[model samples]
Structures are given as C-alpha cells and as structure tokens.
Target: MSELNVELSETERSFGLRQIPAGHARMLVIGRCLPQPIGEVWNALTDPARIGAYFAEPQGDFRRGGDYELPGFSRGTILRCDPPRLLTVSWMPAHGNGGELEIHLADENGATRVELLYASVRKRFAVMDPEVNEWAAGPGWEFFLDNLSAHLDGREVRPTDRDWQSMEGTDRELYEARNTEWVRVREEFEREHSPLPSPE
Candidate 1:
C-alpha cells in the first residue's frame, strides 16, 4: 500500500478515508470539528437559513418527518431528528441514485464534533471503481465544513463559494494537492482491504 506524503490541514477530513462495509452497500462517514459549542453548532445545522450559509440552501420543510428538498437538487425525507445531536435523512437524487444522510453532533472538549454519515449510496461509478466515487463527494464536503469552521470563527459566510473554482488561486492549489492525496489514500485503502484469492 502506498503511503500518503501530503500534509493535510486540520480541516481536510475527506471521504477517501471513510468507506466501510454496510450490508448491501458501502457507508461513508466524514467528520470535522468546529470551535464552537454544541448548542450553537446545532443551531447552524438545523436552522434552515444558517444551513444555507455553508451548504446547500435548504428549501421547504426540513424538520423531523418532513419532506426535504435539497436546495434545488434532490428530494429527501427527514427520517429522524434529535435536536443538536443527530439527524437522519434520505436523499433521492433526480436520476434516482440516492442514499441516507445522517449527521451526528457531540461535544469534544468544548468544540462541537460534527460527524456526517451517508450510507447505501447508489452510485454506479462506485461499482465500476470504488475510489473513483471519492472525486464526486470528498472535496465538496471539505469545502462546506471549512466554511462552517470559518463561520464559527466569526468570518462572514460566503454562502455561494466553491474552493476548486471560486477560491483564490493559491487556495485552489492547496486544495488540489490535498484532493490528490485523498485519491491516493483511497486507492491504497481499497487495495489493502480487497478480498484475498481463494485456494485452488
């Protein structure tokens, strides 16, 4: 297995490291810590307006047992909610490839540790080549979580900003390097965990 050589930032937790076996599908968990209390962190997540500041602009009902439409993208159902602690939802994409999105909040010392789990993702690309799917989910979540950290640091939220494109040139360079490392790590992880050959 290849070793990762890049120095990752504190906020660079991406999807390449979190693939786990989940029955019929793979489960991906991504997490980051915001230097804020759990209550405030929870507010930012559950409050639709504040959520839009970092991630997608959530519209329509987004509460427990309500139907949620992710900004202008997918239609989902809010399966469960425990204020400031956990949330579970199902995302049904436009073309019908979707999965369960679960968010967990916990107190880490004083900061809020935010863990997001997306399970049973139905992406054909994952079957074709598992590591390839990281390209689709990793960087975007990294950007959004970084935005959350920025927001908690009292920086104004740039509601519609993207790293690879909208970020300043130097910033994108760093992100590109980080993304490259993520892909490499994922490839190695898959190789290291692949099933062994059966005896002849």
Candidate 2:
C-alpha cells in the first residue's frame, strides 16, 4: 500500500500498520507522517478542542497520571507527557480489551513524523476477527490521522475518511488485502516464535 494522499503527495511521509511478535501477544503499531509542522501536529493530537475538531472529544485532565474517556471508543490514561514530543497512554476500549499506546513525534525536515505503538493486543481480537488484525483499531486510527491532516490544512475532513467501516473503492480493496497479509505474517511469526510445550 502507498502513503495515503489528500490531493498533494506527502514526499516525506511514511505509513505502516504492523504487528511485532512478543512473548504473550502481538503489538499493533500504526505509524505515519504528516506534511505539517511538529508543533501544529502536536497540538492537533494533544489539545482537546483541536482533537474534537478532528477526532472524538476525549474528556480528561490530559496530564500525567490523568485518564481520558472517549465515549464509544477508548478510555486512555496518560502515562507520560512531553510537550510536542512524546505521549504514552494506556488504552482500554469500551469492549474492555486494553493496550498501551506510545505516541512519538519528531521534526523531519519540515514535516512531522508521528509513530504510535499500541502494545499487547489481546489474543481474543485475533481469534475472533483474524480478518482485520488490530481489528477496528487499525483502520479507525488511520481515519483519525487523515482527519488530523485535514484539520491542519484548514479544510473540511473528508466524509469517507470519518469512519473505517465506511471504506470504499481502492482504499477498501487495499485495506482488506493488507489485513489479509498482516494475518498471514502474524500467524507465521507466532508459529515460529511460540515456545514448545515442555515434557508433555
């Protein structure tokens, strides 16, 4: 899959959705870069008012040790906060499955590179819906990231970009194909890395 476009090509942009195998569960990491300044991009992510303009309005103190509630989505606790640089949060979706999210930001030339790692995805998600690893979480964040780009550019958020379930055309096809590949790779990684039963 190519880096998503919103009219102009993001020359310095990078995009990825991958699972890193671990002892217990795979880590779901979705990363991308926006063709925007680091400060602006940081504000777009951290400011509640700015976030509400793009993503859901999270209710929380938004400080270290504070917890945020994004109704109908994920409830997150602020584990660490560093201005315009890094933010780590513990994410627990309404379904009760939990994970750790590490948000890292940097200035690359003039664009902002954002990397998010959502760690220790529960086994049940893959077991229940192997078709979409990260399940709704992957595509959902992708949508929000697109909205963040829109918010920075001072344009209306693309309607189709609002929800992952409403994907269409080439994006839908590519997304499904990518998911299939992820499932295959993750299964292979698990099979190879899984420790064998001892003294059975």
Q: What are the per-residue Cα lDDT tens digits for candidate 2 across 1-200?
A: 35444322321222223332222334555567778989988888888888777767789887999989976568878988998899988878756656677778999999988886665445534222534324454444455576788889998875532344456787565455555544664566567767422111
Candidate 1 residue lDDT tens string, 1-200: 22222325454343322222222444445677777999998888788877776667677776777897875456788888998799888766555655667889999998888887665445332212333323244554555576777766778654443324455664555556556655664566568756422112
TM-score to true structure, per model: 0.72, 0.72
Candidate number with greatest lDDT = 2
Clashing pairs in 2: none
- Show how many residue pairs clash in every candidate, following the order shown: 0, 0
Q: Which stretches of candidate 1 lie over 4 Å from their true place?
A: 1-7, 12-23, 123-135, 158-168, 195-200
The C-alpha stretches of model 2 lying farther than 4 A from their native spots are: 1-25, 124-135, 158-166, 184-188, 195-200
Query: Candidate 2 — worst ten consecutive residues by lDDT sum?
Result: 7-16
